[model samples]
Each structure stands twice: as structure tokens, then as C-alpha cells.
Target: MSKFNYVLNFSPDTWTPSMESKAEENCLGGIQNFPFAPSMKIDRLGAVCDFSYTSYSRGRDPKSSQPDNQDFHLVDSRPFPKTKVRYVQRKFQKETAQAYHQKQQQQEKAEMLLRQGKKNAKMRQAGTQQYQYSRHRFVSRMRTLTEWSIEPLSSWISVAEIPLSSLPKQFLDVSKSTIEDIGWFGTLKSYNKSMDRISPKLPMALKDFGNMEFLQPTTSDDEILRDALLQPEKNIDVAITDQILACLVAAAQSKYSWHILVTNVDGKLIFDKQDGSIIDLITVNETSAEPPLPDNVNKNNRPHLLGLEALKSNQNYTQNIQINGDEGIIKQFEPIPFSEEHQDANVESKCYRYRIFSLPPRAGASSSENAQKTVRVAIRTEIDAQIPNAESENSGFIFARALNEYDPKTVKTWNTQLESQKGALLATEIRNNACQLTKWATQALLSSCDILKLGYIVRRTPNDRESHQIISVQSYKTKELSAQMGLKEENAWGIVRALVDLLSEQPEGQYVILRTPVKHVLRVYRIPDEESSELPQDEQSHKE
Candidate 1:
């Protein structure tokens, strides 16, 4: 049999009586026994057994093999001196570098403060107020008006001061009385009288008034005005100049695009070009004033129909004037007394005023260029969404008329425009184009009675060329299904499979793939069609 059965294990006890004698005998045996001693018989098996017993029994189980000494002993001393010296040198260098950087920071801060002080001094000297040239110019023009007319009640109506350059030499030499009291239609009448004044014809149209207070100005307006002013060689008609100025003023009031509409004085629509999708553009005259309907005629009434004016005679009713023979109870109607004081109270003045004029783009105009140019003057600026405060008035403006360094020469058309076309696919163009198969798949996926939902798997693979695939029409084995579902069948794979099948059946287009794992929904993006996958992101995305 085995010698292992003869071995005996004992509990760990250093105080066993036989151990002290055995240890002394073993020490003596180790010292006395030599390989040359013929008198000493060596039993290898017995010696091995004795060694095993000594190692296993009465072993030091209560004690650990850790060093007992706490004091440090210098075993290797050469590297310590060099390491200590290097550490001291590094500490000194770090302190020097920190001090130098601190000095530099202090110097920079002092210079910045000095520059700020100089800027403050200059601002104080310049009176800290921006020059408002618009109000000044308006006031100067008003002061230059030498001609005035008296109304029925002696109220003064200022005759518009027409620049001599705007009219022909014949009109300048003609009597000023011909231009007087042309009524609210004075501007149009003047333009008609000086028909040959235009060197380059301008399209006349009704102004579409936009928000005036919050308009962001563009660089094109500035350039146009500057070119008109500085370059006298340019054939800019007075009408064109006036129209441009009106458009600029309207743009300065709002960032929205206003359509150019040509209409008559009686508010008849002639020509209109759509500006934007927002339908709030209000048609006004060249002076930017909306036309008001006459009190007798409703604006909605047909222009051909004329209604007779109703009689204004008042009927008085008094209970005191009633006859004594009257049987029915007569209701007394008394007029409330009007107070002169209340009627004489002055109303508050308006903060802003608008003027209206007929645009140059009349229906009978000879040239279509003026109308086209006016219609093409589309300008819009992005409204700043920053929190409003006393400061931060610098709003950003984007002028589509000018090209930037980074902007493409040809603006890339949006995919949405193509997608909006009938039967246009945004992603992959159909290859097989089988309508029946797709229809059947869509019907099968939508059907609630289908029991083989776990057959399909929508999975993403490592291959970039074919990263995503939906393996439909293949059922999962019982073991695999149990493993995937953590041994509980909740019909999760079935639902995913149905969704995948439905999406795959649709004509190549944008599709949303959603997954509900725990409580919240997760999005798993499948690869789109090969062609659309390479299209650049939206301009807004690039900006962000």
C-alpha cells in the first residue's frame, strides 16, 4: 500500500515533551552524521518521514513571517545620496520657475490696467455718446422746408421738399404751385408730371411694412447707399434711390423678409412676389403707411358696387311728451349730458409715425426689370436670442447678398427640397422595386397574431461596408432564445423583429429605429442608403 497512511498529523504545540529531545538529537545527528561514516546506517524513507512530520506538526501557525526589526539598517547606501541631491535641485528649479511666472503675470496685469485707464480717459474726452445721424438728418431736412400751405382751419401743412436733382430741369423751372395741395397723392402726381426725370427706370410698388424697432442692418444696403452717394457716374434714378432707402429702413425695423407688392392708391392688388413662408407681411404705400378704408365703404365690399349714404337725422324720444291716452308702459330714453371739459382733454402724442406712398411698380409699367429687381431684394437677419439686458445691444447680422471666404460659390441645395418631390427617395434608390413583397412584409409585421416574432434579429456588425443587417425569416433556437432573454420570454425579440421588418419594407428613406430595453427608449442607428450617407450636415449643425 501507500506510505501516506503511516503518516500522522498533530495539532500545533511547541511545548510537546518529545519535541525538545528530538530537536536536540536532530542537531547532533546533522553535525555527527557524514557521508564517509560506515558505522551510521542511513534509512532514507524514515529520514523523509521524520522531515515531513517536523514540517507539518508543531509548525508556527500563530506567528507570521514578517521582519521583527523596526529600526532601519543601511543595506544599500550608494543611490540615496544622489537621489537626495537631485530632489533638492528639482525643488529649487520649480520655485525659481514659479517666481518668474508670478512676476510676468503681475507685469501683464499692470499693463492692462494702464491701457484701460487710457481708454477711459479718451472716452471721457469724447463725451461717451454715439452720433445719431438719422435724427439729425431728419431735423435738417425739416428746417430746409421753406414752402408751407394753410388748411381750412389755418393749420399749416408742410409741402414736401423735392430735391432738384430728383426732377427734370423743366419741372425745376415750372411754378411750385402746380405741386401744391396735390393732396395725399402729391408724391405720385409729382412723379407723373416729371415723367422724363428718370434716367434709369424704377419699379413702383406698395411697401410691405415690417417691424421697425428691431431690424438688423445688412452690408448690402450700406454698399448700395454708399455707391449712390460717392459714385455720381452710376445711373441710379431718384426713384430707385428712394426705393432702396425705403427698403433699408424697413429692414432696419425687422429681420423678416417683406414681399414687394405693386398696388394702386385705392388698395387694389396688382403684382405680388412671395417673400417668405410667414404670412404677416403687411402691404403699405411707399411711405410705409397702411391704407385705411373709407368710413362709408367697407374694405371687403366689391369695388364695382356703390352703396348710398344713409340719412343722419336723429329721432328724439321723451316720456314727458307722451299722450295721456296711451295704454302701454312707455320706456323713457334720456340723453347723457356731454361735458366740454372732458371733450377738450388733449391726447398723448405718438412715439413713432409712418408715411405711405405708391410703389413705382405700377401694372402699366413698361420695364419688368424694375419689378424683378425689387422682388429680388430679399434680406433677413437672425434674431438674437440672448437674454435682454441694459447692455449687449450688438446683434449679429447675416447678409445673403455677399459671399464670405468660407461660403461655397454655389449654395448646396437642401435634400428636403428633393425629398419633397413625388416618389423621391432620400436614401437608397430602389433596385428590385417589388411593391408586392414590401406590402406583404409590412402587413405581416403589423399583424398581431403572428407567433414567430423571435425569428428575426436586428444586429450591427463590425464591417463598415455592411455594418447593420436585419436577418429576417430565421427563427431562434430554444436555447439561444432563452440565453438572450435571460431564460424569461417577454416577447422582446418579437417586438424588435416586427419593427425591423416594417422599417426594411419601406421605400429607401429616413427611418427611426427605436429600442426599449429597461424603462427608457434607446436609439440604435442602422446604416442608411449608400448614396445619402456621404451628404454633408446642415448649415446650422456646422455653425453649432
Candidate 2:
């Protein structure tokens, strides 16, 4: 069999002995064949085994000896003395017993002190107490003292700017009021003023509703409508009501008597106005979807949103699409749900389905082989494996690999300092080089390719008899790394990690096109030439 590298992901992780046993059993049972090891991490600091997974079966142990990763040695290295394990265990037991005895003594002392204190407090209640007498106040004081260890890092961030709006509430005030209430807001007064524009009788008149489509209605019933239609966490206007309305209207304009099933973001049925019967209620099992985003697009690009938030929130608003016919207008679109957590999703990118249905099936592979869930699970597992654990980490951690010419650590530290000081100068500095934190963090992670390449294995279950689940990881390992530079196994990690990252992201390799009134051109560029292009000497180093 050919040696192949596999990236094993444990939902919880790290490989342990029991998992190793199970894997051996499975292998012996003819379930599968071959041996697997957690990937080793190599970095500039040198390669170190990152054995987060303890459940992984090391190998078949005909001999009784088993050890944690690094517990055993190669032939050249000195063997572990026969007495080493026993000595370590004895020392551990001895220390444990001492600790237990000390703890008991401490507890007795504490009890005695508590009793004395209680007596003193009672005496004070008899008009002789030395300090505050209220038991509630004493507990409060203790809590306050305990809190001193906590560094004050406010999670409340001060956004540089917010568009003239709040986070979308579950209920948005009416986005549109009646025509009589707000009236049409365009350059044209009535149809008479702009009669020459177009034949108004075409199916739907193009009157400028201005911002009315996004405005909150002033009436109480509109508020009631919102309350009845959406979830407390979602606004129906964006996900369902408004989008469905646009879809239905577009469908209507096409002369199709079509009614669509509008679903909540969760894919639960919100409206199923099927062709004329009592708008039937139908609920099918949930579905999921995934769609990719443009590399240059900011996450927060809402057509209606105007500023900073619109720049940061990478929320999807529209997608270029050709519906039933090709070369159609840039119709309103909702991206197929990319996050599988919300089960009721359908991919907006119908390209795959289109391609498949267009092709003839081959004999060996079944269409079900392309089941989207399996594909998605594989993809998610791969991508998520690259991400760092964010739990218990303040402000969470961002994967540096996904960033574009930026470091996350610098930006975060600057922001954190700025928030702590509330100083104008520091704030201004932070604003100026605002990307430093993001850049730094990205650089750090990228710099430490060893940790990533080796994979983080952990055993989450410490006591499972049959599983080596010390931290939830089964095993993690890196694929065979190509030898780069003159770095040894230890030094190779960072060298290749950075090298791979650099090669993947070429700064000059951006596309830009210019349009002159009636025409346009497509252009591609690699990094600007220093000799041909006017690259300042000081600025040249930043170019990669």
C-alpha cells in the first residue's frame, strides 16, 4: 500500500491509547488496513510533536510497554530505565498524600477561624462587633475582593461608525408605509411630468420608492405585522418577507402565476401560498447550502448600508444571477446558506446542479455519491481544522491564513490599548494603523506553521476504558512536507508555512479593468515591477 497522509479530525480531539486500540481492532477486523499517526508540527523554533490526541492507537503492543507520545525513544536515544516509571508513580503518590494531609490541616484551620469570626460577628451584633455586621455585606465584600484578580477588559467595542440603523431586530418596523402616507419620491411629479421616459403601462411602473422599501412603517399594525411574522433573533423583512416579495413580483412580471414557499432562515415554512388553494402549510425536512464569496468583497457590503459596518460585517445581500434565461438582469438574490448550523438552507450557487444535470452519468459512480451533505461535511471539517480554538479566548482568535496582507494581533492589541486608555492620541494612532492587530495575529499564526502542520491532537475523555479520549482529538499530523531551503526537520515548519502562504498570495496578482463610457477591458497584473514601475525604495520591502 502507498503511504498516504490523512488529516483526522475529532469533533471533541487528540489521539490516545484506547482510540489506538479501537483503531487496531477495526484494522484487525478487516474494517480497514494501514497505520496512522498524528501529524507532527515543525516550526522555526524546531519541530515538536503536538500530541493533543491521546486516543490514537500508537501501534499493536505485543509487548506490554505503552507510552504517551515522546515517552519512548529511538535506538540511539537512551532507553527509559526500568525503574523510571515506577519511581515517577511513587513520587506522584507521595506528593499526592502530602498534599491531601496538608489540605486537611488547612481545612481544619479554616474551620476554626470561621467559627472564631462568626463568634466575633455575633458579639458585634450584641453591639460589640469590630466591623460591618451584615452577613450579606460581608459576602458582597468578598466577591468584590475576588473580582480584583480580573483584569478589566471591556468587551464593549466603540465602533468607529455605524450606518444610520441598529442591528436588525427580530421585528423591523414596517419597511414600507402606504403610498398615501409617504408618497412616491422621484424627480417626476405625476405620470404627466415624465410621460416621455417610458411606456408606463408595461406591467409594473418603475416609480422611485426612494428609501421606502427599507423604511420602518409608522403604523402600529406594521409593528404587529413584524411581531407576527419573524423570530426574535431575525427580521423577516431581510430574510423572507421583502426577499419573497421581490421574487414573487419578478415571477409575476414574467407572467407566471407562481406562488413560492418562503422559509425562515431556519428553513421552516413561513409562507406557502401555492397556486390558489388555501395557502397550504407544508414542512419538509431541512436542507443546507454553501456559497463562496469574492476575495475582495468586504463582509458587510449591504447595498442599503452606507459605512464602516457595511465594510466589516461580510453579510450577504445580493448575488449576480441569470435566472431562467442567461444574460438576465442582476436580479435580487439570497446566497444559499453557507453555514450548515442553520439546517434549512439551499445553496444559492446552482452551478453544480446545472453542470450535473447537463452531464451524462458514468457507470461506476452513483449520483448519490455527490450527496451535498457529505461534500459539505468534508469541506467544513477541512476548513474548521485550520481554525484555532476560540473557546475561553477573549475576543476569540482569528485564523491568520484567511487574512489578506494583514496581521490580527497588532490590530487587536492596539484596539485593546485604545479601549483601555480612552486617550485621543492612542485612539488616533490605532485608527491610523488600524490593521496592525489583525496583521500581527495573522503573522504569528503563519509564522508558527509547525503547530498547524503537525495538527493538534487532544484527548477529551480522560477515563474512557476503550477510548483514548484525553482531549477529544483522535490524531493530527501533517502531510509529507517538501524540503525547502536548508532547514532541518525542526526548522522546516515555519519556513514552509510562510513559503506556502506567500506563494498562495501574490500581491501584484490583482485584476483591474478600466471602462470608457461604452466599453470595458479585463486586465491582470502580478506585483509591480520595481525597475519598470516607480516603486519607492522604502516601500519596496513591503511588496511580496
Runs in model 2 lying further than 4 Å from the true structure: 1-544
For every model shown, the clashing-pair count is: 16, 73
> Candidate 1, after superposition: displacement of residue 258 in Å?
16
Q: Candidate 2 lDDT, tens digit per residue, 273-308?
A: 222111111101001021111121442221111111
> What CA root-mean-square deviation does each model show from the true structure?
37.4, 37.6
- lDDT value, candidate 1, whole model: 0.24
Instruction: Please give the TM-score that candidate 1 achieves against the real structure.
Output: 0.14
For candidate 1, the C-alpha RMSD (Å) to the true structure equals 37.4
lDDT per residue for candidate 1 within 367-438, as digits (tens), equals: 434331211111111110111121322211100000001101224321222224313321111111121112
Candidate 2, residue 300: how far the Cα is off, in Å: 25
> Candidate 1 regions off by >4 Å?
1-85, 128-544
Best by TM-score: 2
* Reference-based lDDT, residue 253, model 2: 13
